[model samples]
Target: MAQTNNATLIRREIITRLCRLFAEGRLEDIDRIALAMAPRNAQTNGSRCCIHKARAIIKYRIMALLGFNVADETDELESLYSYALRALAGTDRGEGVLTVVGEACTSCVKSNYVVSNLCRGCLASNCMVSCPKNAIVMENGQAKIDSLKCVGCGLCKEACPYHAIIYVPIPCEESCPVKAISQNSEGIEQIDYTKCIHCGRCMMACPFGAIMYKSHLISILHQMMKADKPVVAMLAPAVCGQFRASYGQLVTALGKLGFADIFEVAQGAELTARHEAEELGHVLATGQQFMATSCCPAWVELTEKHLTQLKPFVSETWTPMRYTAGLVRDKYPDAVVVFIGPCVAKQAEALKYPGVDYVMTFEELGSLMIARGIDLQVFEVEEQGAVIPERQFAASSGVLNSVAAYYSGEQIKPLVISGLHKKNMAVLRRLATGKHDWNMIEVMACEGGCLSGPGGVSSPDVARKLFNAQSGVHTEMLVQ
Candidate 1:
C-alpha cells in the first residue's frame, strides 16, 4: 500500500512496532529492540551524526508510543525501558497529549529571507529598494539580508521579479494557528500547553518528526486484553472512506478486536443538529448577533483560550464524539468507550468527557490493524444496521446543511470557515467584534472538514471520492 507522506509513514512505522511489541508481550525488551532499530554499527548514520544519536531519537519515539512525553523534564532521568515497563504494568500514563522530541528537532534557522542561487545580481536592485528595514544590501552583486534587522515583511521577495529571495519558515512555528509553538533559548521548539489547541499541525509540519503526541494505544490495548469490562468503539463520520473494506467488514473486524459494540458518531451528529438548531432559534429570538458551531473542539478551544469575546457565541451542545460516548454509556453503563476518529483535537477533547475512555486517530487505527494482521478483505461484509449521516457532515458544508434543514422557512445567513488558519483568525476576530452580517458560522479547524484531519489515513480529495461512492449504497439503508 502507498503511504501518504514521510511523516505519516514514520508515525505508522513507530506505532506498528509498538503494537507488535504489545502483542508479543515483549515490554521488557523495549530498550534492546528500540536501540537496535537503527543501524548503530553503520559507517554513517542515516539521520544523525552517529548510530548512537540515531538510537537516541528512536528511543524518544518509542517513549512517545509507550505514552510518555519526550519533552517532560521530570522524565529526564528515566529510561525508555522503564517507561515501557510502566506502560505494560499500567502504572503511569502521560500527562500531556503532545510533546516535542528535543533530540530530533533540527533547530531550523529563524531567518525567513534567504538569497537563493536564482539571484542574478540585477542592476535595478528592486529587492533593496523595496526593503523598508534597509536590511537588504547588494554584496558582490548578490542581495544579502541582515537577519538582525529584517522584519520578515516579504516585501523584498515580492518586489523581486526573478523570485530570487526564498522564505525559509520554521515549519512548526508557521503551521501553528494559535502561535503556541516557539523556539526555546537553546533553539529547540516548545509547545505552550495553555495556548495549544492540540490540532497536531506542528507534528505534521516538522520534517524531522520532532513533534508527536503520546498515544493511548497501550492503554486501549490493555483494556482489550484485560476484558474486564465491555469496550465499545465510537467511530467518526470520516471513517466512512478511511479503510478499503466496507463498513460491515470493518464492523466485523472491530468485533474481532474485542469491541463489544460499535457506535457511529454521525448518529450523535444527528442529535447535535437538532439541539444546535433549537439553540440557534433561542439565540435568534433573544436578538443575539450570531452564533458559532461548537462541534469542532479545536475551534471551541480557540474561542475559549485566545478569542475570549467569541466564547459567549459558541454553542453549548456537546460534540458528536461526546454525545456518542454518552449514548454508549447509557447502553452499556460500565463499558469503556474508545473514540476512533481523524482529528487529533479529539484527543484533547476526549479528556473533558469522562464517558470517553480513550481517543485513537484513524492513522493509529490503521497501524493497529496492520500490527494485528487483520485482513479486511477476508472479512465477509454483513448487515451492520448503521445510520448513514448527512454526507456533507464529513466535508465543509455539512454542518450548515444539517442546521439549515431544521430552520427551513427562516432566512438564515450562514458563513463557513474552512480550516482555522491565520487568515481565518482575522475573519473570526472581525466576527467577534459584531461587524459581520452572518447569523450562523460553521467552523472546521481542518480543511475539507474531518476528512482532512491531521490523523486521517488518506488525503481529503481521495477520502471524499470514496465517501461519495459509498454514500449511495448506504443511504437507502440509513435509519433516519
Candidate 2:
C-alpha cells in the first residue's frame, strides 16, 4: 500500500511545517508558508513548470492542511491567512473527507495501450492478428494504435513479440476498486462521491499528490490547545508498528501533545469480536451462508455503494473505533474524542459515529510529534510479560482470529481479502451470488491490513515485520 515517493514526502513536510507554526503560536504567519517553501533562486529546483506554479500548488496544499477543501475555493485571490482564520473559527471543514487539488493535478490522460517506437513491424503481424477491435496498424515501419477504436484491453501490448506496445495507466483511476474517480473534459481528475468508498486509494495513488483529504489537524490542535474539555485520543492497534515507538511510549507522546486521556481501540475490538461472534452464530443458526466483517469503513462503504446485495451479509457489530469512542463518552460524556489511527476512511466514518469528534492519521500524528519535538526513542517503559488481547488487532486476519476465539460453533472457515483490487473484488462479487464454504470474510482495504492503510507512515513490509515481532507485548496497562 506504500510506494515510497517524493510527492508523499512533500505533503508530510507541509503538514509538519504548518504544525510547527501552530505549536509556535504563529498561526497568523500561515500565509508565509508557500513563499518560504519555494523561495527565489533556490539551491535546487522542483519538477514543476516554474517556481510560481510549485508555490501555487503548495498554497492549495496548505489550504487542505488547514482543513479547507481546495475544490470549494471561489476566489483565486484568497489568502492562506484567511483560511487559517476560518479554521480557528471552526468552519473550514469540507463536505467530504477528500478533494482534488486542481493546481496540483497533472491531468493524466485515459489509460491506453500505445505502440512505442520499438515496434519491429514484423511480417508476422501478430499485433494485427490479436487485435480484437482491429485497432492496430503498421505505419512507416512501426506499429500504430488507433486510439479512437482502442478499448485498452492491452491485447496488442501482450501479443507483440518485441513488447513494443506499452500500456500507460492513470494510477488513481486504476487503484480505485469502485471506479469512482475519472478524468473530466479538461482531463483533470475528479471523484464521483456517489460511488466512492472513501478508501483513499486514489489519494494515495495520485503521483502528483493532487488528491488530498480535508485534514482535522488544525481543529484537533485548537481543541487540545484550548483544553476546554477532555480531549481524548482513541488509538488503533496498528499504531504499535508506527512511530518507531513502543505502545507505552506512544501513550506518553500523546500526553506530551496535550491529550487528556488515551484509549486503545483494541480494547473495544474484544467487544466487537464477541458481538460479531454472537451475530455470526445467530446468522448461521438461521441458515445464512456467510457474513463479512464491518470494521473497515471503506469496505462497508464499498458494499453500501457498489454491492448493495452484499450489504445483508455484512456484520452489524460496532467497529472498534466506535466502541472505544462510546467508552470514552460513557466515562466523560462531554469529552472531545479524537481518533488517531492509520486510515483516511476513519475520518469520514467518525462523522457518523457521534462518539468521535475528529480523526487524525498516523502520517499526521507523526508530523504532530515532529512539530512538538517529541521523539519516540526517548520514552522507554520497563517490559512486562502480561498478554494483551487487543494487541492482536493490528495484523492481517486479526479479526478472524479474534472472532474464532469467541465463536462456539463449528471451526470458522475464513476468507481473507487482503487488498481490494479488481480481481479480488470479483471474488467478493462471486461469493455474493453463489454459495461459498467460507463462513467469515475479512476484507482489509489495505493489502497488509491497517498498518498499510492510506494514512500509514511506514512501508507495508517494514510495518508487518515490526508488528509481528511486537504484537501482544506492548501497551499502556490502564488504557489497553
Candidate 3:
C-alpha cells in the first residue's frame, strides 16, 4: 500500500513537469540552461550536464511514487535519467544502449525444459541410439532423463522422429547475430554485453516487452521552454515517411513548438553534393583514387570497430545532420539547436558537435505532444515550404544520384554503398588499400539509409521503398 502511494506520487511529478514545460513554452530553454550548467568533461567535452540533472530529479520523483525499492530503483533510475537526457540531446550511445538491451534480452524466456513422451519399451531404443552425447537412457520401461548429461542439444528431438520433442527458444539467443546469448544454471538468459553491438535487434525480438527505452521528451520540453535563445530544428529526411500526417503539417507542428525555422537534412545533402564535387576535384588533382562518404553514424561506428583501415577514405565533410546544425549555428549564433530524427546514432553525433544541443527521436516527440496535451491532428495547418525536387537525396543513394545529376557536361561515374555493416567494411578496405575509383561515393548505414535504422517506426524495407517512391513521384511531378 505504501509502495503504491509512492509510485503514484512519482508518476504525478513526471507528468506535472511535462505539463509545466509545455504550458510555459520553455522546453528548449531548459535544455540550453542545463547544458550550460554541465561542467566540461575532459573526456566527452562537456555535454548535457544540466539537462541530465533535471531529468534525474524527475525520475527520482517517479521512483518514489511508484514504490520502487530504494536501493535498486535509485541505481536504475540514475541510469534511465542519464539515457533520457542523452535522447533529448541526441548523444545517447552504444555501450549504454547495449546495457538496456542486455537486461531486456534476459527477461524473455518462459521456460527451459522440453520433454519427449515417446519413450517405449522397444529394445531398439532409437532415441538413445541417436543421442550423440549419450544423454538419454531407458529405465523401468520408461525414459528417465539425466539433464546433467544433456547439452540442451535438439538432436534427441530430431532422433525421436516421433515428433515428441519441443523447442523453447530464449529471446536473447534468438536475436543474437554473434551467438553470444546463453542460459545460466537457473534457466535465465544471459547476454554477453561486450559482444553485443547495440543494434537493438533483441529489443524488437522480445515477445514479453521487457526491453524498454527511457524517454527524454519531458526534460527536452522543459529546456525548450526555458531558453531565451533562438531554436532551429533539423529534420531528417526519413521523417518524411514516419507519420501518418503530411510532411508539411509536421513542419507546421514543430513551428508551433517554437522552432524559429525548419531545414531539411536533404538541403544539407544538396550542400554535400556540392562539397563532394569539390572533394572529387581534389582527389583527381591529388591522384587519390578512393574516397568514402561520412554521412551515416552507424556505418561510421562499424568502420571504427571492424574496419579501422578505412577511416582514411571517409570524407572529411560533416554529415548532413551535423552540417545542418553547423548551418543553423552559423546563421543564428544564439540559437539552441536540436536534431529531430529517427536515429539513436544521431544522439551520439549531437554530443560530438558544439552547435547541436539536443537530439529527439520521433517517438520522444510524440511523447512531448502527449505530455503537453497537444493533439497533432488538432493543430491549425500552416503553409509548408515548397517540396524541393532535388531533395530526394536525403533518402537513399539519393545523395549519390543527386551528385550525379549536378554534373552535366562530364560523364563522371560515382559509386554507391548502402547498408550499415557491409558498406562500412567495404569502404574501409578500399580507403586503406587505395583500390577503387569514383568521382564521389554515397554511403548510408542501414540497407536503405535512415529509412531502416534501428529506431524506425515501421518495417525497414517497406519504409525505404515507400519514401524512395514518394520522393521519386514528387520529383517527377515537379519535372512535368
* Top candidate, metric TM-score: 2
Winner on TM-score between 2 and 3 is: 2
lDDT per residue (tens digit) for residues 8-76 in model 2 = 888888999999999899988887888788888764355688878888999999998888878789899
Residue by residue across 341-447, what tens digits does model 3's lDDT show?
76765655665567777676665555455555666566555555466544565455666666555544334556666553433444545655655455556666555
Q: Give each prediction's root-mean-square deviation over alpha carbons.
A: 3.9, 3.8, 11.1
lDDT of 3 at 105: 30
**What is the per-residue lDDT of model 1 for residues 8-54, given as tens digits with 9 covering 90 to 100?**
68678878877777888886676775455665567543557887777
- lDDT score of residue 272 within candidate 2: 94
Q: Sort by lDDT, best first: what order?
A: 2, 1, 3
Sort every candidate by TM-score, greatest first: 2, 1, 3
lDDT against true structure, model 2 = 0.84
lDDT at 319, model 2: 93
Which segments of model 1 are wrong by more than 4 Å? 1-3, 41-50, 73-77, 88-95, 117-150, 154-164, 383-386, 390-392, 471-480
